[model samples]
Target chain A: MQGVRIQQEMSLFEKLNILSDAAKYDVACTSSGTDRRGDGKGIGNCKAAGICHSFSADGRCISLLKILFTNECIFDCKYCINRASNDVKRASFTPDEVCRLTIEFYRRNYIEGLFLSSGVLKSPDYTMRLIYETLWKLRQEYHFQGYIHVKAIPGASQELIQMTGFLADRMSVNLELPTAESLRKLAPHKSRKNILGPMRLVQNKREENKQEIAVYKHAPRFVPAGQSTQMIIGATPESDYQIIHVAESLYQKFQLKRVFYSAFIHVNEDASLPARTDEGPPLLREHRLYQADWLLRYYHFSASELLSEKQPNFNVLLDPKCDWAIRHLEWFPVEVNRADYQVLLRVPGIGYTSARRIVKARKFGSLDFEDLRKMGVVLKRALYFITCKGRMMYPVKMEQDYILRNILDPREKLPGGLGEMGYRQLSLFDDVNFREVKAE
Target chain B: MLKRRFICTDTTIGILSAIYDAWKMDRTDTEAGIPLWGTVQHEMFCEYYEVEENERKAGAVRKLIRERLGKQAYSDISYAILSKDEDKGTAILQTMVAARELADSHRIMEHLSHPAVRRVFEMSRNVGREAHYWEEFLRFREMKPKILYAEITPQNQVLPAIADHFADRFPLEDFVIYDKNHASYMIHPRQKKWMFMTDHEQKWEAAKELSEEEEAWCTLWKGFRKSISIKDRENKKLQTQNMPLRYRGDMPEYGKS
Candidate 1:
């Protein structure tokens, strides 16, 4: 690959411009505190939650030199700019070019490391090999110790995927679509088999590494940052049930560090894609999915609890947890003072922090309505479900829809007469006026 | 609104000094702070007062945090205040004061359940998350002899902490991270910029910055971002959140067509 490229013809700045830009959208670049050590004379250490240089507006974090091996790809996916059929300029970087740029950027303290991906140049194996080789050079010849997140090209040879496990700190194979059929439709060149094939192989390899380390205490490394994959939500017609079901399996089977949900974009305005008229995208739906994802990962809520096949979509108005609580009335009104941590967590307006607060505050004093509010539980949703000293706040009937109305109500909410709001319930342009709101 | 000025080495240390002095003043209800306001003069009444910075006081504050809040708390809150979010400073103050009621450090997260505390906790989480991402997603290029330039538009005031992280990690490199909302920093480990950018200005000259080869690379990145997959278009909402519009100006993938 290096032989095919003109190195002297390209400077370090040129490589960075093409490579880093090409690489930016790959979501796998994360450097939480490896906060460990540089190990004698080696370079670089990781932070636990990771260190960030900046944030992209959509509020996604940016930490590394995220870019692709080249913007040149063979696959003509309907949503991608790099698809072969697209009329776009292309650029590729040699292994040496990436190495010099990464080292220069690292030495200059510009980035934490390199997050290298490609647009599926040539074949899957060909693309994977170039990325794998880049890491090998950075690690071996340059003695680069910074974090590396390499894209595991789906359908790439198993040997190539294994090499990623061995060299990179993290490896990812994006589950471009939530379901098999959608995968076939949007990314026709891609398939469930092709994507999951590398995914399963990486998962197995990571498991073997974990097992090896468990026994020997020091085993051959295999994606120590672990494997993560992304699911493009909202692009196809997959229901939340379909999304969560896939997520549940990904978690159970892959031991993935995270299964990122990248909402799809209409890059080409294909006749096949749905046209969103009013809103540019479904931010609320995305928020709900994140909430559900949190439920699945941290909260004990299962995919079934959050959504069912019958109800394919989440309630646009009510949060997933609140929506779940309303459906399961019997579980509510549990004595907060005595309920288990998990039970307390199940209440709406209560998160992990509040759940622990209830646990701790309860030991000091029996929690009532006032006590609950002070303890950090927002009572709007919890009001109907909880009681103070064996007394319901303002009892009345246990009508699910009635209680759901006020909690999810948009009319009376907000500061200075902001009308019925969106998913987060703040008025439109809330993000724009955050400063003004804070002042108030 | 009263205006007071104190000179310190740099931004973080300066902010820390001001915070320390605010702690020492023993003001009740409202805090005694500096207004990162004022054109050239450092003075009063903002949406909120920027804290007054003192070196000894700031150092003591750091010690106090390490003692009371634990080491992680120190790093967490410090990083939180530096996020690109406008509310970063005020949010940390609330979180810090709330956490003080508890003796143990972990109790801070418990305080985080409260709305005021939650705001700061969210800020910390945001900054921490962004820091993690910034450390990963930053695109860097060696402009000329030793000029390492990178552009970023974060939602929080993360550049300072990120700078600190980068300084330690890359002691030899001199780089700049542009905060699109505010002004860009002229950063370098050799001679770090040592003042608050209260009088900072913006200079976005495009022609000189991009060479022909550099332009080609950006074109490829842009092309590639357009190709990934379309069936996932329903997730545009998620995509929008993950990569907000405000950032497109600097993002190589969405360069001017």
Candidate 2:
């Protein structure tokens, strides 16, 4: 372990070059998830966009230098660049190098904080120990009370993982593959057990911290941004049902902050890897996963109700809600003013924001189309499902055909629509000119 | 594409008053005409009117916004109009009119909920959210001139909100938050004015060596980072979604450690 005094050896410039270059591939540090506040001391705070910088060529936001400790590896994960056998340019940072770079970049305001991940340097614990040392120095010696999002190395020791919670604002353990069997095939060195062991430990610790925070006024700090994990969508053959099922379990069991869906991009062309070339990253599928994920997280929808092993994947044309609403048409035609909160949440057009608004405004008076619009209900989706004052806006007749035409027919998605990529690609004038290009 | 111009010396208030006066003069039977601030070609059909800087008029306009649209609405809409949204001008006007018509404590919120109002509110609210988050995410270290500097290239105009937010949140500090896309500053929290600083003036170098103390602090910071994550439920997309790469340079959460 490089002592804290290693800062004198490398200038902040050199540290930034090495660490930021190292951090470029992590694909973590999406900062909008957390809600950390400004204490009386310290100069910086968090923003929803978390101070955007630039986007990578693949249309993903480069919010942080998503990089790793070193490209050297002991494992041969088929999809990974640093897979032990690959001959890529390798780099590793002493704990001191990482600490120096972080402080330097942080000082220059070129970055938010570090998203430090590693490629099994010697072992998970060995690499994690260096990371732990780096963070310890940043927080204690520099008194840097800013955002820090670190990665929890799978199979790392419990105390190492625990120390991360105290030091960083957010941390993540990536679920690279949705299914373990597929993971075994694609990433042999990485096992389901090694990946999830530290995850479970972190889950338990955060739970304990949450309980303490709830019961007592104060508790020893945990990740204020909380713990999150990433899953590569469309890489393996796992269905959306399988993805959601795993996600729901994670949320319930581990209390994860978020479950990010990275539509797998075949960064390297490895034949052994389940080739993602034909489909690229299933951007549309990934978009649907996010919609379904949002439903699970905010709309209180259950995995069973949304999909099953029989019907594994979500339909690309229709959204999760519309698809569900169409299947269970018996639940439709609920009067806006009368439906219960959970029932209201099930409506196709109504979102958490709109549903809450509907609840508030309906208390004032019965809602009309105008009122629904005022209440932030996305009428395009809502109109097919709900009735105002017990009367459907359109003639109430054969429901399946109508719902299918409106919601399902546009699976490939019509032009000028609000579907993820379609809407953003609106005007030719709106190329890179429109900067909020993050697909998530 | 001839249009009126006003280089109001006062802040957003003066500009808003000029907008109000221009809007009043351009009323037709059905559609209202507004000279969107910077896009005019100064053609023959469109008359070019210049408005002088007037604090009294600015005050009068501020009073009207408060009386009609509530107090916070002025800043909210002014910031919205000055924001980088393509539809900023019309949105500000529509929200302003909508707020005036509603004229209650929750009027701005009511407009925030209104579809047309929400369109603008969402734009500005998003801008505001990013700016606010940038404050927390931004990591700044010391440089020459005693200025704590950070740079960003956001999708929206966020300096004002970010600057104003940093002031309340990080009071008694001297900093310059710059947007690289558009050369502007969330200027001086201490000075309380929006200004611009060129790279030459700032003389800031991005990468440098940290002090021994700083290195120690970074390691501790990473140690704290190590503890926060529960590995089981990680979602890379969600992490990327919040802390988009575009905003990373300024985020403290993802800086080096």
Candidate 3:
């Protein structure tokens, strides 16, 4: 653990800089899931789809006034920059300051709402109390109806957690790492049991509140947008399969709205952590995991279906859907005009919305290739998997190798750094072409 | 016989009136065309007639579409009228004409096989998406006397589309959003419903005078945005992709830095 340096009489500008910098590593910045209209007396409202005012240079949406209530901590987590053992500047904002900033920024359309997180200052109860007080002022006194996402501190009393959940739109408790063994290794002061305790509490309270609302018409909602959690990826030696399985259980058992995966950026040099490398955070792996995460949530795929013990990681060159489609080639050549909605979803280029549109539009008239393109289907990829009026788009063969060679076209746009990895995959075949050219 | 072309101004009432005239002249898609008043490109063998552009004719057309085509199609046609496309009037007129052939007139929007209906659908989606983008990227600065003022230069006429959202969100505050491209204003007084005004005189210099506390808050917001980004994960291409360059001119964080 590193020693913290307490700064005296910090200005609001400096406090905002230090505190928001501390909170940058906490990933969930979304303001979605809850839609609340203003009551004609309040100063703000929320949109269910969420609105992003700006995107930072890192390309992440600046949807909320994401800041820590304080940077002072008692715990010494190995991967954290604000651990007690590290020598970093510390600052805290009064509840008044947080409310004012949220109000002013939200009025200016700079943020959708406030995302308030804090370190375990003194005790979890004390920190949670401070958060509750701030939220109370923002909701009760200031009459702010906009989105509020707060962090439920692990090990806090159930009473305090329950009371705070009523005021927040969304609540989150960081799982920190995937497995209990890895959590014990990196975050010594924290335990998996302590984290899941508050998560379960929020879940049960929300269930009770739902019934209360059904009976009473207007009972104050308990985390109305639902609870979400995040875990740092690549921090522990867990495979993608294990991480996603954990996510699956969290979603099914606890009913989480989202599970964010942060590609662990090396912030501290600790013996327990992986050594520093020229390769930055595992963004490509994180990207793949999110793609698979969507598969689990929206595309009706199980963790085992996407990856098994035999293959535990996602393919770096292709997306999870395309990879799955290639491996299971038997599902190809689905008739567009007659295929069920579920079958249309499994096609490579068709999204959920496009599938729905196809289902609706085909009822009026049988759709052809041009109609599918207008309905937002990416024909470049779907041409191989789908047919129009029982005829394929082209005479392309349905062989796996043939499709893989064409699907991995250099013209296709890949996510940021993964394009280079795609080229590397193609270079394996390029070697034979190079040998032929050399002989010539 | 030649096609009958009705010319009108580029507005809701004008387009609706032209649609009324076209519907009266011919219910067939191939025989009638509606083009904007000033953007008419004279075609050979086409009889061009200027629409009267009155509220009564527009009202009758609006009532007819609402009663026959259902509320969803009516809303889609309304959004398509707000699009920036020059052929929007013709597309919508053809779409309504095509609806006459449907078994259930309300299901015309679902008939994407008709090119005219598909065109109206595409234009409506474009206008709706642009309006949503403005909702996300529009920045308001507190002007003198504590009035929130914003300016946007959107390609489509989106001021009317997004006025209700902001008015509901900020019912207690007096705000005015100026659409520079359309030269219109969406003004909402405190505790009052919003209204739209066009062809109004403007003094752009007066709106630039911000309140005393506005600069301080803007500075604080800019600092927070800067610190909230991780240095290790800086990707400018992704940043531009999410928040495009066109939207940065008015955002304080992206202004002059």
Candidate 4:
């Protein structure tokens, strides 16, 4: 193709354009929790609170120099834009080129670190070696102490993955599809065992390195921020229940710091993939899953509690917490003054910060609804579920549907794009600026 | 109930020394005996006692705070000093006084019921949040060889909090982050220590014309930003929520790319 042929003689910027666009669908650009400061002789350092240098049009935070090492692949994954079968432009960055780009980009303070991933080229070994060389050069030669999150080629040798782990702050092996069956159907070259194998290796290496550092005090860190993995959502017909459980298992088994979910975009024409629709890539579903995941990680919620085979999906109208609260009505009207911290956390409006604030504020005096509002509780949502001094904010019934209807008030303003006339086509009246006057 | 107002400079040390002078003035007979106020304008109907900044007195109060409370409280006080709140100096003093009587006073950070304690805590958290955001939002342009310059207009005075992070991240380069609102700047010279210059006479120079290579990189960055978005998920509302419009002016991706 013309695009493919022109790419062979392309400039570095052109290559970057193609490769970064190819890589964007993966959706794991976080650069958090790496505390490796520059060793005075180095060029950069990583702080715990990751810097988001900019935001893309998609509203995703750009924290790293997220680019694929190359777009030349050996396998044909149906969902991937960079699949070998696709007649798209291909480009690869040399080790020195990647180093130079990272150093220069970092010097201008454009990025916090580099997130290097790639499609397989020639062999997994060769592709991995090139990545390792780039990272090794960046760390050893350039002395770039900034965060580096690299993707581990699933079937790459244990030695190559281990060597690269020492040079990176974080490593990820994309568990692209959740289940083994879906992975087989979509990515024929990728296997669940091959992916999990390297993930296990990284986990073990981190464990061993932790012990080594406990004794030696300088036994080079292994993925100091720990490994994170991403799973493609809305693909292969996996239920929300299944996806949530898989993420939980990954956290429990692999010790992952994060599990990113990418809403499946129908990029290619394949019989196995879902039909393309104007409704877009299950963005709302992906949002719900992230909310549920937050509950799992921070709110001490179990996946079973959030979802079950009986009720497989979350309520699209209400948040996961509200839905849960509606289902388990007996848990409602939790006395704010009497409930424990964990109980307070389960209340809809009281988040981690406000729950703690409530507990601390109650120490000096008894807190009313007004006090709860002052302490940052979302009273509109929390009113039905919480009580101040054993009195509900309103004389409300304990019926589920009633409470749900009350919570989803007709007058209550919904988040943008979820309200009336949300997806309306352009109309003559849409541009009119009508001013409503109040009657005296 | 005429209050004895201690007028002091705006720095943390100035306020602390004022607190020290008030504590030693023996004006306990009056109902609202002594209150610390910064030189900055404030509504007042009280006798003003000008307290010159005494490092010795400030040091004594600092030691008293450390002895009664702990190191963490001292740091909280330092963070509170960076708050733009007009009542910050008084809030820190009252918080210190209240903290002495509280049980496990070191953890007096959790005592949000006391108005002063809450104010100090909220002020510190606000400053800390701004510093955290600046760590992420501050954009640097190479003005000269090995010299990187960034400009920030943060809500609070946060240059002092974020300077070490950049210096540590780029130890071999000279970087300066100017806080336009506070009229202060932090400079980190190559391989040398980082330092803060407050109320300096230097006016900010316009951002230099980007080098050809820098221009190319900016173009590439903008391209990456444009190419990354799934057009169907273009939520300008959400984008503005995450990366505010105020921060977009300096960001290359949002600039004339």
Candidate 5:
């Protein structure tokens, strides 16, 4: 192909542009979940709360140097921009080139670490071996102790995956689509079983490594930052209920660290995919899913509690937490001075940190609304649901419509596209902006 | 009762020395206050005193807080003293006095209902957050002779707060982080301990000379940053919200080279 022929003359600048542009669709750019000192010998360290070195125009945190090792794929995934059938510019970085870039970038403090993903080159095993070699060089030869997040090719052998896992801080295998049926329609080359196989392997190996480290204090850790996965939303017709249920089970069954939801952006057109429109990606639905995902991980909530088969979608007008609080109004007016930490968490505006702070601070004295606000509780939202010293922040009735209308004020900030929808009741006949507000 | 107000310079040792004198007075919370020098608002029926700032009195107060109120509170007070707030000194003094009423003096941080303790908590949080921001946004450039030089215009005195982090991360490299706001430098020499220097007379003209390879690497980084952004999902509001415009001045990707 012309792209292959031009690769020989491409400069490092051209290669970086093409590769990072190709890898921009990836949603996981975090450098969190690992804490390691530099050992006073290497070049970098990991902070538990990851540092965002910069942010891109898309507003995503540029924590790592997110790039594909090569844009040469054998698979013909219809949704992928770099699919084999596509005629995009293809470039591959040699192992030495990647190491040089990582070490130089580390010295400049431009990035936290490296996020090395790749397109399948020739075969899954071949691509996995290249990734392994690149990581091995970065860790041993370069003495780079910074964070590394590598992708484990779905069909790669178990031995290669385990070898790469030891050197990486995090590993991931993309679930592609939420369900297996949708996976077959969109990504014919990727099977659900093939994707879940490596995920299960990493989990089991991590468990075993934990026991090993318990016995041997300095035993080398395997995937010290744990593993995460991402799935495309709005590409298929999966409901938010189905999507989060799948995420819940993955967190429970596979013990994954994070399950990222990427709003499907139209990069390629195919017969089975949704028709392209100028509405752009479903960012509002993606935002709601992330909010609900945080609810599952930190707020001790279940997928069933947030959504169900009857209401299998998030409200475009309200967030999942506020929606839940509105539906379950019987649990309102929770006494701030008396509520348990879990109960305070269930309040609309109180977060995990604020809840903990409230629980700790109330031990000294009973908290009022001012103290609650000082402790980081959003009183404009929490006032409707909480009471301090047996009196609410405002003298308002506790009714569903009244509270919902007040909470959904036009001034309250909504995610990007949803701001134009206004505060009107959802009428069955009014589908004027249906394409924009469509919940995935 | 006449209120006794002790005044000192705006440094960690200065604040601690004021606290030492305040504690020695053993006056009630309403009768004693510690304010920074040049920021004290004189009031009637108030006896103003200039504190004799020294390392010995500061050491005594540091030891007292660390031993009585615990290391966590001591660290909080230390960070609070680094803040630019004029009332931080009085807050730390009142917070230390409040700890005496607690059954477990070490748990004074949990007494957030007290206004002075809460003020200390807020100031420490603000200083620590600014320090963390410096850790993320400070960009190092390769200067002549292979020295890594970075310049930051931080709002607080965060050079001391972030010195250990950068020193530990780049132990083998010689780097200098100059704080433009504080007129100081944190110099970490190769394989040696990091030290703070406040020599305003030192010429910095030579440090501006960049290495030959610096521009090339910066161009590559700028290109990578531009391409990695998905144009269809561009949201300048969110971008500015995540990385504020103030931090963009030192970053090469945001530079106009």
Candidate 6:
């Protein structure tokens, strides 16, 4: 890997244009869950319902001023545009430059916060320290009280991470690959242990700091919004079961707030990498994983329940909840009025809020299909699973193949574009496309 | 054949006063159904009973609500009154009467079978959804060093709901979030109180020109917006679904387009 040649001639705007463009591929741009009212002395506050100041062309939220501290790297990761061997124009922001951009953008309300990630400039420690200084200056000097989500570089010093964690609203360490073997194959410089080590440290310190703040009101918050991680899907040869298990374990072990799944877009032209196709990034797979992930987080679904070794992936035709319900037909025809909140949650069309509403609304009076529709339940899906007072919306068979055919029938307003998605069985031997997966 | 029509101002206090007046007349008789009308009505041959906005009368009704119903019920009525629904006034009044008779007004809110309660619930939900959307969609562009400004045209009167949010968000910076559709402005002075001014008497103007730094930030933001999306996965339908076309004019990225 060749050394980075820092561009001395780049203007601040030029650097912003380059670095922000470089940072675009990273998908964790959420600015949520830290509700801080601005102190009279500070410049900004954060709302728990994070504001999306703008929408990108890909329909993703632009809530933060997401930019790379530098595009210069010391490691040659094949998936990244900023790899040391890549001949991209490299620019690094001075701590002051980052602070100024953050403050200015925040003041104008162009962003809700700053999402500062970087490539390995010299070493993890050096890059992380620069990020820490930028955050420190933004918080202490500029008196910016908005949300800040910073990446905890793998293999960075623990002290630097702790310091940055205190300054940032949320901290994250990207796992990049689902398994260590894949990490070794795709990103030779990065190890699973190197990434998870800082994640564990942040988790422990955040837990400790939470206790400290609970006891002492004045103790400063350490990642008050908690931590999250991202995994690059389709880049590795891991099955959906493996990916979900990795995520589920991360949630249980490290106590991550979220595990973002970024669909891999093929970038580099290497003999070792798979050739790109017109099919593009595996967006449908990524979307399915996200839907499954939501089921895990909010719907009280275990990853194993959503997928197994037998069917190791989600069906592209139906959502995770509906698919699960159809596979296990015994639980169908749940009594809308009598079913508990948990049972109601498993119903295909009933969401968290709608399920809660059913429980609340039914106590006052009897709820029929009409009442359920008014409460925001999609009757087309829920009718097969739910009964109002002992009668189904329509007499339906409990047979799996029968229900599947009926549900997939084009007459029923299928979810989004699922109806048009050409049915193809999950392939075990299809040559996977090369997707440029970044761990940032 | 005397028609008792209640003419009232189009405000929370006005509506409450009208509700109080209407609630007192014929609690059970179908023939004596006192129809509530805002000042923006012109109905001939009806005996018009003008209900002025009185704090004492409104407070009495509010106290009755707090005593008979719960605080949640009180806020539900408050939020329901902000809806543009023409029948919201009568629906809330009917709910208040029905709710007063019930053992639990809170429980009555979930009784969707009842017409009055259902209407009130729907109106409140509409207001809540609109307010939640504005909390996300309201964009503030810097007009001066400490002053920020944005414009919105929401379906409901959601300025009051989001004012406290922006005030808490930017305590040190003054911002004016003008609701163009409702002809109201949520103005928060730096390090001071925030208020909703409904003086539609003066036409509000957009900031003539963004400051130099503000312009740069807008340009940078526009650049970031274009650069972020993967061209292969561009979904305009989903984009509009999340951020409706109504909000595009104020957004810098969509402003030029």
Best by DockQ: 5
Can you give the DockQ of every candidate in the order shown? 0.09, 0.11, 0.80, 0.66, 0.87, 0.62
lDDT of 6 by residue, A1-440 (tens): 97454446778778887898888778898888788887778877887767887677778888898989998888877787888888888788888988888887776567788999999887999999999999999999989899999999898999999999999998999888799988888788999889989999999998898899999998999999989999988887789999999999998899998999988878776555557876777887898899888888899999999999999988977888889999889987889989989999999889999998788878777898888888789998888998888999998999999888888766544443343455567688865453534332
**Model 5, residue pairs in steric clash:** none
Candidate 3 per-residue C-alpha lDDT over A1-440 given as tens digits, one digit per residue, 9 for 90 to 100: 97465447989999999999999999999999988888888788888999988898899999999999998899999999999898888899999999999999989999999999999899999999999999999999999999999999988999999989989999999999999999999999999999999999999999999899999988788999999999999988999999999999999999999999999999998999998987789888999999999988988888998999999999987899999999998988899999998888889999999999899899888999999999999999999999999999899899989999999888766776564454344454444566777899
Runs in model 6 lying further than 4 Å from the true structure? A1-8, A409-440, B1-5, B23-48, B63-68, B144-146, B200-209
Write model 2 residue lDDT over A164-198, tens digit each, in one string.
77987788888888888988888887789887887
User: Which stretches of candidate 1 lie above 4 Å from their native place?
Assistant: A1-35, A40-43, A103-110, A141-143, A215-220, A269-279, A367-381, A391-397, A409-440, B1-168, B171-257
- State the C-alpha lDDT per candidate: 0.66, 0.65, 0.91, 0.82, 0.91, 0.81
Give the alpha carbon lDDT tens digit for every residue of A58-91 in model 1: 3444457777888888787877767787865567
Question: Candidates 1 and 3: which is better by lDDT?
Answer: 3
Compose the digit string of candidate 3's lDDT tens values, residues B52-112.
9999999999999999999989989999999999899999988888888888999998888
Name the best candidate (by TM-score): 5
Give the B-chain TM-score of model 2: 0.68
lDDT of 5 at B218: 96
TM-score of chain A of 5: 0.95
Better of 1 and 5 by lDDT: 5
Q: Higher-TM-score candidate among 2 and 4?
A: 4
Which residue runs of candidate 2 sit more than 4 Å off their true CA positions? Answer: A1-26, A38-43, A47-51, A103-110, A211-219, A267-272, A275-277, A390-398, A408-440, B1-160, B168-173, B176-257
Model 6, A189: alpha-carbon shift in Å? 1.3
lDDT of 4 at A395: 93
* Residue range B1-257, candidate 2, lDDT tens digits: 44444333223554566656655665221222234456534555545455665667667766776676665665566556556554554455555555544436345644334554666666667777666665545665544455565667766666666665556445445666767776655555454544555555765443344334544444543433332332322345556655556656544445655
Q: How well is each residue in A1-440 modelled by candidate 5, as lDDT tens digits?
A: 54435336789999999999989898999899999998998899999899999888989999999999999999999999999999898999999999999999989999999999999999999999999999999999999999999999999999999999999999999998999999999999999999999999999999999999999999999999999999999999999999999999999999999999999999998998899988989999999999999999999999999999999999988899999999999998899999988989999999999999999889898999999888889998999999999999889889999999898767767888775566578788975776777864
Positional deviation of residue A40's Cα in model 1 after best superposition, in angstroms: 5.8
Clashing residue pairs found in predicted model 4: A44-B169, A45-B169
